[model samples]
Target: MKKVVVTGVGIVSPLGIGKQANWDGVTSGRSGIGPISLFEPDEGLITKFAGEIPEFDATHWLSKPEARRYDRFLHVALAAGLEAVEDSGLVIDDSNAQRVATILGVGLGGMPFLEETIGQRIATRKLRRVSPFFIPGLIANMAPGLLSIYTGARGESWTATSACASANHAIGASLRALRSGACDVALTGGAEAVVCHTTIAGFNAMKALSTRNDDPATASRPFDSGRDGFVLGEGAAVLVLETEEHAQARGATVYAEVAGFGATADAHHITAPRPDGDGAVQAMSMALQDGGLAREQVGYINAHGTSTPANDKMETAAIRTLFGDHAERLAVSSTKSMTGHLLGAAAAVEAVFSVMALQQGILPPTINQFASDPECDLDYIPHQARKAEVEVALSNSLGFGGTNAAVAFRSAR
Candidate 1:
């Protein structure tokens, strides 16, 4: 099997626009969640706050015409993907364009666009009034399709849609492509922009979002007794991945090795994780076994702590089941407590944080830890960041439909 490595990463998160900005925010325990300013909430809407990138202007990264044609999701995807390629310093010219792949994960694409178009069509009572770009603009696969056209990389281009676990699946597929010699380089991650009426209303109906409109910053209290629900977040992230030999031949700087990936289905529930956390335990165990790592070697875990009662307790139980005595020693944290939940893009951004943690020897903090939940007992690196040497890190993403995925990374040094 070919050794895969992560050469570059790009982030368009609520924390900030770029990688450095997000790092600073997480390390400083700053929360990016706030009031919902994108649209005025109706009187009946329960959750009015979200982790939105209010300062993100599409014109800054895309031309006016291009910005006008696509949805917000595509704009963020292209921006992050281009930034990743530029960071990697990998020239995709005629010599190696065919060996590069673009793959991304997206859960709900262009909900705002769909809502607007449907409204306009209903109001006018004319189906032909819809814009020609409506279908292409809202489809999930267009993210990677447009990226391939923009970067001129033709190896394989596609999108993975698995709800919240979408990004981890995309990264896992990229690992397979590199290992099988299908592609020497891959731009893989996830993008999502669903901070709109339909998404909010749907989640609100399901009671899946936090209703702490008064204090939005402290709403995402993962593993805390006061945690009500998760805060919806919007963003995109891209990681430049390549085989070890291919990266070394080009002298690209390696941040961490893409050691292994593991995915499983709970076969238990639609939205709720198994109470015993059997599926999560299996996913993490498989990830460690695939990476040839001992359970004790994993120093950090970026948990799938969504600030929900069921998820937090289940994930904690899963960790305890998998690592046993070593679970207490692990430095665990949930960046979601600060950045909110970015839906499908959550795992990708978490993966970037995990890599950064390995490189900098600093553990990002899980803020808003007011009161702890006894069932969810762990270090959690609460309230403030901690400086520590971490040799191996694991990022876990558990999504809807009982999907669970984990990706492991090792320090390049």
Candidate 2:
């Protein structure tokens, strides 16, 4: 099997616009959650806070006319993909460009555009006013389309629209392709730009969002007793992946190896996780086994702690069940506590954090963890970052529809 490794990463998240900025924000325990500014939420919307990118200029990537032609998600993918490619210093010439693939995990696609423009036009009975770019903007696969166009990655261009587990699945798909000798390199990650009124209202209606409007910074308190629900966040993240041989040939700086990937479905609920967390356990177990690593070998876990009551509790139980006593020794944390929930992009960004932890020997913190819940008793590494040598790290993404994904990363060093 080909040894796949992560050579570069780029992000445009609420935490910041670049890789270093995002890492700085998460490790410094900065909360990106704040009152909605993209669009005004409805008066009764309880969850008014979100993690939104404050400043994004498409001119940095696309021209004014080009930016207007594509949707926001497309712009995000292009920007992040370009950054990842540049960071990797992987020259995409005619010889090796065909072996490159583009796969994206998108949770919600073109939602903001649909909510802000098309929906309004149709509601007002101006159906003809819908722009010609509607379909181009709305489809999830278009993310990969833009990425492939930017990176010239013609092979296996697609998107995994698995609700929340989308990005991790994208990463997994890329890993499989490379390990199977299908593709030599891939730009795989996730992007989401749904921090709009309709999304907020929708999550609020489902009671799946935090109502901590008074103190937006502490709204996403995963594993904390005072936590309510996840705060919505918007961003795009991309990782440049290539075979170990390919990277070494190009003299790329390898950060971590994609040692293992496991995916499973709860088959239980649409919006809730299994009560026993068996699915999560299975995913984690398979990932570790596939990675040829023991539970004790995992030094840290970038948890999918969505800050919701059910997800936090179930994830905790699943961790305890999987690793038993070793779970206590792990430095577990949820970057969601700082960046909020990036929905489809959550796993991609968290995966970057996992790789960063292994590369830098510093773990990101789960901020806003003031009070702990008895059920979630573990070393959450709350409120402040910690410096520790990490050998192997697990990044978990459990999305809606009971989709669970666990990725194991081994230190390249």
Candidate 3:
């Protein structure tokens, strides 16, 4: 298999609009959660708190006419993809455009726009009133399609959806494609912008959102005893993945190696994780084996700690099962404590965080961990950042449908 490496990364997250800003905020232990401003919600909708990316001006990133046709998800993906391509320094000319593919992961694509269109149709009873771009804007695959069109990429382009694990799966799949000589380069990541009234109400009704409306910043307390549930967040994250030989030939800076990827299904439940964390453990072990590394080699972990009661404890248990004694010494932290849950986009951003940790030798913190829980007993690196020499890092992402993925990254020496 061809060696794969990440040459560039771009992010449009709740913390900030670009890679630098988002990383700075995450390392500094800043919280992006705030009062909802996207739309008005009723009292029962639980719209008071969310990790919203504030003041995102699509027109600034895209042309006015293009911005109007695409949905917010596509706009964010295109903006981030452009940034990643520019950062990678690989020119996508006509000669090699056909060898460049785009794979994006999205959970709820154009959900708000679809809801608005349905509402208008019901109110006006005129199906023709909908814009011609409605269908293109609402499809999940449109994010990658728009990217391919904008970049003149004529290779395979599609969207992968596995709930929150969507981005990890997409990135892993893209790496496989490059390794197999199917594509020379790939743009892979995930984007989401589903923070709307109906979505919020649905999560609220399911009791799956934090109710800390009065204190938005402290709402997403991962591994904390007082935690209730996850706070919804929105954004996009993209990475430039290429074979090591290709990147070296082009003199591109290699961030880290895409060492291994493991995916598993619980086959147990739809919304909740397995009680014994069997799927998570299997995924982690498989990733380690595939990376050709032992358990002790992993220096840090970017946990999928969604600030939920079940997920935090279950993930901790899974880690302990796989790492054994090394679990206690390994530095584990959940960036979600600061960024909240981006759903489909969560894993891609967290994977970026893992690679950054391996590169910079710093572990991001799981902020808002006021009181530790006995169930989640590990070095969470709570409430503050830690400087450590990290050579290998693991990022875990679990989704709603019992789908779990674990990715391992090694520093480029």
Which candidate should be chosen as best, given lDDT against the real structure? 1
Clashing pairs in 1: none
Candidate 3: tens digits of C-alpha lDDT, residues 111-154: 77777766668678887667888898779999899888888888
TM-score of each: 0.98, 0.98, 0.98
How do all the candidates rank in terms of lDDT, highest first? 1, 2, 3
In candidate 3, stretches whose alpha carbon ends up further than 4 angstroms from where it belongs are none
> Which segments of model 2 are wrong by more than 4 Å?
none
Question: Which stretch of 10 consecutive residues in model 1 shows the poorest summed lDDT?
Answer: 115-124
Per-residue lDDT, model 3, residue 366, is 92
Model 1 lDDT, residue 388, Cα: 91
Please give the lDDT score for candidate 2: 0.90
Task: Supply candidate 2's per-residue lDDT for 251.
Answer: 91
How many pairs of residues in model 2 come into backbone collision? 0
Decide which is better by TM-score, 1 or 3: 1
